[model samples]
Target: MNGPALFYDKAAFRKAGLQPPATWKELRQAAAKPTGGRSYGLALSAVATEEGSWQYVPFLGSGGDLEQLDSAESVSALTYWTSLLHDGSA
Candidate 1:
């Protein structure tokens, strides 16, 4: 059987003219906005499975360093992720 929709609020989103963010920076900014405590900026599947790997692909791809995960670009990407977590966006 097919799984439930991974995303919620499709109808509301349609009304709001919402579109998927084109860049990580845009996503981060959106998530950081205050929405009267009724909205979340971001959420990712951290479950120990393929979903986790999928969630991480953006950072890895942006960094362009698979062999050296600790490269400067990687660190920057990780820092961005940490900021989302700290800001309660992720």
Candidate 2:
């Protein structure tokens, strides 16, 4: 599949003073913020659908060696996902 449109609501983001995060750590930390009376940081698509796989792209991309799915980086990605679930963030 091609993917969803890569558009950003610049006006809304500008109104919120949102800047592009420089690192993955920053992104995760930002996501962990409590807002709108919600406890979780971000929303994840766990449904067995195209969106679910799409949502997981970052982890897969971060694996460094896509040819080796069982690489340490891939394992780390899975671990992070599990951690999010255990901590009620996923």
Number of the top-ranking candidate, with TM-score as the measure: 1
lDDT digits (tens) for residues 1-90 of candidate 2? 534332334554465465545666655554444323545555666879876766666666565444666789877777776676666644
Residue 12 C-alpha lDDT in model 2 = 42
Per-residue alpha-carbon lDDT of model 1 for 1-90, expressed as tens digits? 213223535654455456655677766765565323656756776879876655765676685565787789878877887888877776
Best by lDDT: 1
- TM-scores for every candidate against the unseen true structure: 0.66, 0.60
**Candidate 2 residue spans exceeding 4 A from truth:** 2-20, 35-38, 64-67
Q: In order, what is each prediction's RMSD in angstroms? A: 4.7, 3.9
Q: What is the lDDT of residue 42 in candidate 1?
A: 67
lDDT for each of the candidates?
0.65, 0.58
Clashing pairs in 2: none
